[model samples]
Target chain A: NAGVTQTPKFRVLKTGQSMTLLCAQDMNHEYMYWYRQDPGMGLRLIHYSVGEGTTAKGEVPDGYNVSRLKKQNFLLGLESAAPSQTSVYFCASSYWRGGPESTDTQYFGPGTRLTVL
Target chain B: AQSVAQPEDQVNVAEGNPLTVKCTYSVSGNPYLFWYVQYPNRGLQFLLKYITGDNLVKGSYGFEAEFNKSQTSFHLKKPSALVSDSALYFCAVRDDILTGGGNKLTFGTGTQLKVEL
Candidate 1:
């Protein structure tokens, strides 16, 4: 299985530029998440989708939007890239059974490095 | 809100010695804890998770974690450290009751572990 894959592993954009990061998983998972990794900040959740056609805001949802059009895909969009948006973006997915006690494992994608100047 | 803390910014251990990475969590209900490791230029990899049952959960690459309910901590440990084990380690917690979802993971600031020979 390809597991989780992210497109445009590296990208650079100028201020006000717009772009989308694609995340795909072949594990048939029901939940997908977008996170940004900064130095010493670990990973912060940006947005998430419980399933297709469902999306929710996460801890750091500002300056980002997400869409889950298909079961296997989750897209993160930046309408106007800013320097503060420069970071390593990671995509993750997991299958949900019930509560935290039911399932909690998350598989992550290779990550995309985005630099906005 | 659920949150995690990795007190140490960096940990250094000699190869072949036991290594410990500290992690503490705060949540209202039962916590589903997880450990993830990330190498340079790579995505985070699932190390292990503590859902229920045994307090000591063993996982891939000779890594393990102990869940201490009293202390509200889930610390990652390895019997013997190796140079290859050097990486950034993160502790995450899933708060089902608060988030009302199974996919939300609150990650810590991350701890950088360096195993030297």
Candidate 2:
């Protein structure tokens, strides 16, 4: 099965442009997250969904919005792209939180490289 | 606040030799630690995690992590390094209070591991 898949693997946009990055998982996981990877910054959480129809803010949610209307899909939107938002974006999903007693392993999708000029 | 730290920016090891990537964390309550690997231009892959039980946790690709509660560290290790093991490694943590139903993983600045043949 395609564990986790992201659409538009690469994209370039000018400042003020808008776009959406789509993430889908076949694992039927309950938790999905959007993260951005920057040089020397590791991965910063942008947004997340605990379940379908429930979305929440993450550490770096300032420039992004997320929707989890379907169980398998989590969409990240850039209403107004900024140069600062240029980074590799990743989507991950996991069965539950914590470990041992919970399925805390997060399966990630191939990243989307976004360049905002 | 909760955070993770990878003390080394890069680690160099010879093939067939043991390798260790250091990771330490700071969290308010009990910490749920994780290790992930990222290949070039790809998303992070789950390596392993430490939740409640054992101090040593084994994960995919023959990687494992040792959790030291006193030091608040979860260091990733491999018995024998392979050239294929050369990649960026990240350490992450989830605080008990910030569990938020969804797993909010706070990641450290990654450390690049280079295994020389």
Candidate 3:
């Protein structure tokens, strides 16, 4: 399985520019998430979807929007990019398991490096 | 709310020597911990997870983590380190709370491991 894959491995944009990042997973996962990685900051959650057609805000959702139109795909949109938004973006997918004993492990994509000037 | 801490910014070890990366987490309930590795210019890769099992869990590439409930710590260890093992390591935690249809994980600032020859 290809697991999870992200589009536009690298991108450079001027301030206020817009773009969309596409994430696809072949694992048939019920949950999808977007995260951004910065130096000394690890990875922070941006947004996530429980299933198709569902979305929710995460820890760092400002300046970013997400949509899960299809189960295998999730899209993150930047309405107007800012210099603070320049970071390595990652998409991950995982299957949902209920109850305390259950475990949910996420699989991550190769990441999209974005630079805002 | 959940959070993870990797106190060390980096760790250095000579090839064939033992190496350790420390991690501690905070959560309200039972914690699900995980370890991931990121090579340069690559996305994070799942190395191991601790759900409900023995305290010592072995994972890919001969890495293992010890889960200490009392200390709220899950430290990754490798008996004999190789230069190829040099990378950034992340420790994450998922608590009992369910949000957006699944559990959300909090990651620590990564620890860079340098295995020298």
Candidate 4:
């Protein structure tokens, strides 16, 4: 399986510009997440989707939005990018059939390096 | 609410020596913990996870994590350090209270492991 993959591995954006990072998974996972890793720190969640047509807020959801229009895809958008948004973004996906599988492990993508100037 | 902590910002070990990256977590109930490694300018890679079964879970790259419920710790260990293993290591915990399939992860600040010959 190709597992999870992300687009635009690297990008540079000016302040207030908008961009969307795309994540695709071939594992047929029901859960998808977007997270950002800051310099010399751990990752913080930006948004997540349980399944198609559903999205939810995460640890650090502000300034970002997400859409899960399809089961194999999750998109993260920065409507108004800022310097603070410059970070390494990662996308992960996993399958869950409820019950004991609630704690299923996640598989991550290659990540997108975004630099907001 | 659940969280993970990596006490050391960095760890340096000589090649062929035993190595460990410390991790401690906080959760209301049983914890689902994980370890991941990130190379330079790359995404996070899954290492191992601790669930219901054994306390010691073996993961990729000959890495293992020992889970201690009493101390609420999950430390990553390698019998002999390798320069190729040099990377940023992260410890994460699944949320104990989230309903359904969310079980979003809370990660540590990360520890940079450097193995010098």
- Model 2 lDDT per residue over B30-112, tens place: 78888989999888888888878989999999999999989888999999999999999999987455456476788999999
Which residues of candidate 3, in runs, are more than 4 Å off?
Answer: B98-101
The backbone clash count of each candidate, in order, is 0, 0, 0, 0
Q: What would the per-residue lDDT of candidate 3 be over residues B21-69, giving only the tens digit for each residue?
A: 9999997778899999999999899999998769999999999999999
TM-score for chain B of each model, two decimals? 0.97, 0.95, 0.95, 0.95
Q: Is the docking of candidate 4 incorrect, acceptable, medium or high quality?
A: medium
Question: Which residue pairs of candidate 1 clash?
Answer: none
Estimate TM-scores for all models.
Answer: 0.97, 0.94, 0.97, 0.96
lDDT of each: 0.93, 0.90, 0.93, 0.91
TM-score head-to-head 1 vs 4, winner? 1
TM-score of chain B of 2: 0.95
Estimate the lDDT of model 3. Answer: 0.93
Candidate 2 lDDT over A1-117, as tens digits, reads 999999999999999999999999999899999999999998988999989999999889998999999999999999999999999999999887444345467899999999999
RMSD (Cα, Å) for all candidates, in order, is 1.0, 1.8, 1.1, 1.4
Question: Model 1, B1-117: lDDT tens per residue?
Answer: 888999999999999999999999998888889999999889999999988899999999999999999999999999999999999999998866556674688999999999998
For candidate 1 chain B, the 10 contiguous residues with the lowest summed lDDT are B94-103
What DockQ values do the models have?
Answer: 0.75, 0.67, 0.81, 0.70
Show the lowest summed lDDT stretch of 10 residues, model 3 chain A: A96-105
Comparing 2 with 3 on lDDT, the higher-scoring candidate is 3
Model 3 reproduces a share of the real contacts of 0.77
Ranking by TM-score: 1, 3, 4, 2
Candidate 1, after superposition: displacement of residue B12 in Å? 0.3
Tens digits of lDDT, candidate 3, A1-117: 999999999999999999999999999999999999999999999999989999999889999999999999999999999999999999999998766567788999999999999
Give the alpha carbon lDDT tens digit for every residue of A36-84 in model 4. Answer: 9986668998899889999999889999999999999999999999999
